[model samples]
Target: MRKIIMLLCLLLFLTAAYSYPQSIQAYTAPLTADEQHVLEQSLSIHEIDREIARIESQQNETERSISELSEQLEGKNEQIKDIREQAGARLRAYYMGEREDLLAALLSVGSLRDFISVLDYYELIMDRDRTVLNNYKTEYADLKKTKTKLESVSAELTQIKTNLQLQRNRVAALQEQVDTTLGHSTDPEKLMAMIEELTKYWENIGLYEVRRYFRALSTAMSDFSDFLDDHKDSLVSEKGGYRLEVREEDINAFLRDKNERLQDVSFEFGQDKIIVHGSREGLRLEVEGHYTVENEPENSITFHVDRLFINGFELPDTTRKELEEDFDLGFYPKKIVPFVEATEVDIAQGTLTVKLKLSF
Candidate 1:
C-alpha cells in the first residue's frame, strides 16, 4: 500500500509539470527602432568628441606658436621703425638736395661697418620703402589666413559639443525607460540586426571615388568633342590642292632621271569593274576632285568611273614620295573604311567627284 501511494504521487507531479504552459522568448530584442537610432547617434557622438578634442589640442598648440611668432614680428617691426626714423630720415634729407653734407656725413663714419651702414641707410630710405611695405603686407595676409582657419575650427568644435549633448540626452532617456521597466537587454541578435541594417545603407550609397573618376572622364570627352568641332573644317581642307603643291618637284626630278620618276594612277569603285582610256586620247593626269562627307567621320571613298571624257588624255610618269604621302587615303579612317551604304567616285572632263552615303 505504501509503494502504490508513492508511485501515484510521482505520476501526478509529472502530469502537472507536463501541463504547464511553454514560454516562447524571442531570439532578438523588441527594442523600438528609435532607441536603436539613438544608440547609433550616441556612438557617433563619442567618435566626434574624440576627434574634436584632438583638433582642439592641435589648435591650442598652433595658437601658442602664432603668439610667439607675433611677438617676434612685433620686435622686428619696432627695429625697422627706428631704422626708418633715424638713419632713413637723414638719408631722405640728403637725397632732397643736401649732397655735400650727405657726402661729408658718410666720410665722417670712421669704421668700415659704420660707413657701410650709412650707405645702406641712404640706399634703403625713401627709394626702396616698397620693400618694407611689402613685408608688412605679407605678414598681414598670413595672419588673416591663420585667423580664418582658427575660426572655422572653433565653429566645428562648437558643433561637436552640441552633438555630444544631444547624444547624452538621448542615452539618458533610454536609461530612464530601462529603469522604469526594470528590464535590461544584452541581446546579440538585436545588435547584429541593427549593424546589418546600417551596413546595407552604407553599401547602397557607395562612395565618391568611382563617381569622381566618371566625372573626370566626362569632362575630358566634352573638351575633346568641342575641340574636334572647332577644327573640323581645317582638318577637311588640309588635303585640298595638295597634289599641285608637290607636282613641281616630281616634274623636275623626272626631267633629271627617267626610270627613277615613273609613277601610275588608277581609280576604281564598287565592283572589281575596270575602265581603261589610252594616253593617245586627250585625257590629262591632272584632275580636279570634289569630295562630299557621305559618312561623317569618313570611311572608304570609292571613285566608280575610272575613265574620264576629257578634252585630251596625257599619261605622264612622276615619282614623288611626297605626292603619294599627301594623297594616301589610308591616313583617314573615315575615307578608308566609310561607315556607309556605298561610296562612288567618277571622273569626267578632267574632273573627279566622290559621293558617299554612310549608315553606321
Candidate 2:
C-alpha cells in the first residue's frame, strides 16, 4: 500500500512536470578553442566567487531570522509566565482563609452590584488567562514555520557553498598548474601530460560536468521546441498525442557526436516523452526518454523538466545525487545554465542539428 501511494504521488508529480514548458537533450564534447578554454577558466572563478558570496549572505539571513524567531518565542513564554504568576498570587490570597471564611468575605460585599462587579472581574481574569495561552500557541505555530524555512534555506546554502568550494579548489589547483606550465618554455610533452591530467580530473569531478552538461542540454531542448512550434502540425497527430519521428541517420549523427556505440539501439516518441533505447559501448542503457514543452517563446522562454527514467529500469544513482545537491545548494538548476544553447538551429531531412559549445 505504501508503494502504491508513493507511486501515485510520483505519477502526479511527473504529470505536472510533463505539463510544464520545458525540453531535455544530452551532449558531450572535449573543450576546444583558446578563447573558450580561457572563458571556461574565468567562468569557473566567477561562479565560485558568486556562489560563495550568495551562500554566505543567504545563510547569514536565515541564521538571523531563526535567532529572532527564537527570541520572540521566548518572549511569548515569558508573557505567559507573568500571567500565570499573577493568577497564582490572586488564588493564594483568596484561598488563605477556609472555604467558609472565603464565602463569608464574598457575602460581606457592600451591595449586590459590588458582588456582580467582582464576579465580572474574575471572569475577565479567566478570559485573560485563555487569551495568553492562545497567544503562546499562535506564536509557537509561527515559530515552527519560520524555523523550518530557515533550516531549509540554511541547509541549501551550506551545500551550495560546499560544492562551489570544491569546484573552486579544483579550478585553483588547475590554474596553478596552467600558470606554471605557461611560465616554462614551450614543451609539447609537458603540455600533453597536462591535458591528460586535466581530463582525468574532470571525469573524477562528476558533479561539475553533470551540471554543465544538463545546462547545455536544457538550452538545446528549448531550441528544439521552437523548431517544433514551426512544425507543430507535422509532429502532433489529430488524435492529440505527439509523434516526433527521427530517422536512423539522425541517430547516427548523434552517436558520432556523443561517441556512443549504437548497437541494440532504438528511438521513438513514447507517450509524452522521447524514448532513446540503446547500448552505449557495453553499458546497455535503455528506455531513455526526452521531451520538449513550449513555455513563453516571445522573449526568453524558460523550461522546467527532468530526464524521468533511463534504460528499461530507472535513472542511475548519480542523477538523483546531482538533483539533491542542486536542491541543497539553492542553485536554480537550469535557469542559470540552459542544457543547450544555439545561435542558429537547422533541421534537414528529419535530422535536428544546432551550433554547439556556446558560452553562457
The candidate that achieves the highest TM-score relative to the unseen native structure: 2
Top lDDT model: 2
lDDT of 1 by residue, 1-360 (tens): 999999999998555333321110121144466444434443333334444465566656656665665666566666556554655545566578675666678899989999999888866754555565555556556656656665665666566556556645654664465333333545645554544443332222211211222233223322322332433432222122211011223222332232221223222221233232112111123322232323445443322222222112111111112122223221123433244333454434333334434446
Tens-digit lDDT track for model 2 on 43-136? Answer: 3443345555655676677677767767766676666566656656555655685434645666789999988876676668657656765665
Task: Tell me how many residue pairs clash in candidate 1.
Answer: 21
The TM-score of predicted model 2 comes to: 0.37
The lDDT per prediction is 0.39, 0.44
Q: Cα lDDT of model 2 overall?
A: 0.44
TM-score of each: 0.27, 0.37
